[model samples]
Every structure is written in structure tokens, then in C-alpha cells.
Target: MKFYTFAKSVAYSILKPLYRIEAIGTENFPKEGGVLLCSNHINNFDPPVVGIMIPRTVYFMAKEELFAVPILGDIIRRCNAFPVKRGMSDRDALRKGLSVLKDGHILGIFPEGTRSKTGELGKGLAGVGFFALRSNAQVVPCAVIGPYKAFRKLKVVYGKPMQMDELRKAKASPEEVTDLIMAEIQKLITEYR
Candidate 1:
């Protein structure tokens, strides 16, 4: 927790000046309990930026490849990141993610599954939806908008926690839930961008 706070402060000190970072709609974020922050992926920086901006310790499922890098892997590991295999269902990763949320910590997911090369929001994958339902965590749609040029304004918008009672009653499929979450992210991007 100390390391996370230190890293967040350091990241903010550097990034705020260079990116002109702006975090909006943060009031929509809940102060307690488990939260699933689903956002559109734009770049490698998206995870850290979102992690630092939010007022909670966000444990992310990083790509397995990132864990192979010597220094980066260690750094991210200390930052509460664990590895996840892309393009296939990795049960171990899912279990780890669930454990984090079950312990009442926030989990951050880039629902698009990978970074957008063109800075546009993409279709979300069902993994996030699965987590939302299984963990019963508050699912909050988030948007990170940036071209990431130095001194350029960048925004991270957190939308209200989704009402999942209806979806839960309807017994929604993971894919269907993901679609709604992605649409909400798109809405945030449209409204805030």
C-alpha cells in the first residue's frame, strides 16, 4: 500500500505536468467495496494512469508477455498486477482476479482486451463481463482519452456504477453484459471527449 501510494504520487508529479491530466466524474466512483473499472484501452500507459487517478488500489491483469520483461515485470508485480493470457480463457488468471475483488480491492480491466492503435474505442471482450457477474463487484464504466502528446490534455472519466439487478434477473450472458459495458464506455467517451 505504501509503494502504491508512493508510485501514484511520483506518477502524478511527472504525468500531470507533461500530459495535463484531467480526471472527471470521479465522484461516480464508490468509496468502498469491490469495484470493476472497465475502460477502453489506448496505450500501455492507460493502466498506470487509471490506477493513479482512481482513489483505490487497482489490481490489473496485465498481459503475460509484460511479465516476461525483466524490470517491467517486477515493477508491475509490485504495483499489484498479475499476468493474464490473451486470446484464450485463462482460468488461473480469472481466479486471481476474483480473489482480488473478493478481498474488496478494485480491479481494472481494459475491456477491449488490447490497445487501440487509432485511439478509438473497440468492442469489449466477455472476460470483463464474466468478472462482473461472478464477483458481484460494482461495474463502473471508464474512458481514457488521449493522443498522449506531451503537454496535451488527457482525460479519464468514470461513469456511475451500472445497475446490474435487471441483468442479473435476466441471467445475461457474459457477451451481452460486455456489450452493455462497452456501450457505456463509448457513451462516456462521447460525452467527455
Candidate 2:
């Protein structure tokens, strides 16, 4: 816990001046229970940038390759990041994410699966929807705007908890749930940008 706080503060100090980062709509975040923090991925810096701003501890699912790097792997692991295989379904990763939510913690996921090279929001994968449907976590859509360039203005907007009751009642497919979450994220980007 101490290390997480220290890392968050250091990250905030470095990122705040560099990106002039601002967080909006944080009040939409629930004070308790499990949460799925879904967002669009633009760069490698997205996870730390968004995680630092949120008051709750965010456990993120990073690409499995990152966990193989010598120093970075250990650091991210200590900071609550677990590895997930990209380009395929990794049941282990899914179970880890579900366990996090089931334990009433925040799990951060980039629904697009990977970073976008063109700085546009990509289509969200169904994995996030699967997590939302299987767990009791509240799915929250977020948007990260502006580039990671130094001194540039950037914003992280957290939208309200999605209306999942209807979808759940109807036994919505994972693809359908993903579409709704992605659409909300797009709305945030349009409004905040």
C-alpha cells in the first residue's frame, strides 16, 4: 500500500507537468464495490496516466510481454498489474480479472485490447463485456484525450455507470455489451475533446 501511494504520487508529479493532465467526472466513480474502468487506448502511457488520477487502487491487465522485461515487469507487478496474452483468449487472465472484481476492487482495462497507432478509438473487444457480465462490478466508461506530448493538455473523463440492468436482464451478448461501453467512451471523447 505504501509503495502504491508513493508510485502514484511520483507518477502524478511527473505526468502532471509534462502533460498538464486533468481529470473530469470523477464523481461518477462509485465509492464502493467492484468497478471495471474501461477506456480507449492511445499509447503506452495510458494505464499509469489514468490510474494515478483515480482515488481507488486500479489493478490493470497489461500485455503479457511487458511482464517479461527485467525491471519493468517487477515494478508493474508490485503496482498491481497482471499479464494477459494479446491476440487470443487467455482464460487465466480472465479468471484473474474476475477475481479482482469479485473481491470488490477496481480493475482497469483498455477495451480496445491494444493501443491505437492513429490516435483514434478502436473497436472494443468482447473480453471486457465478458468480465462485466460475469462479475458484479460496475462498468464505468472513460476517455483519455490529447497526446502524451510534454506540456500538452490532456483529460481523463470518467462517465457514469452504464445502464447494464436492461442488458443483463436480456442476457445480452458480450459483443453487444462491448458496443454499449465503447459508444459511451466515444461520447466522452467527443464531449471532452
lDDT top scorer: 2
- Poorest 10 consecutive residues by lDDT, candidate 1: 1-10
> How does model 1 score by TM-score?
0.97
**Error at 178, model 1, angstroms:** 0.1
State the number of backbone clashes in model 2. 0
- 29-77, model 2: which lDDT tens digit per residue? 9999999999999988899998998889999999999999999999899
Give the runs in model 1 whose Cα sits over 4 Å from its true position: none
Number of colliding residue pairs in each model = 0, 0
State the number of backbone clashes in model 1. Answer: 0
The stretch of ten residues in a row with the least summed lDDT in candidate 2 is: 161-170
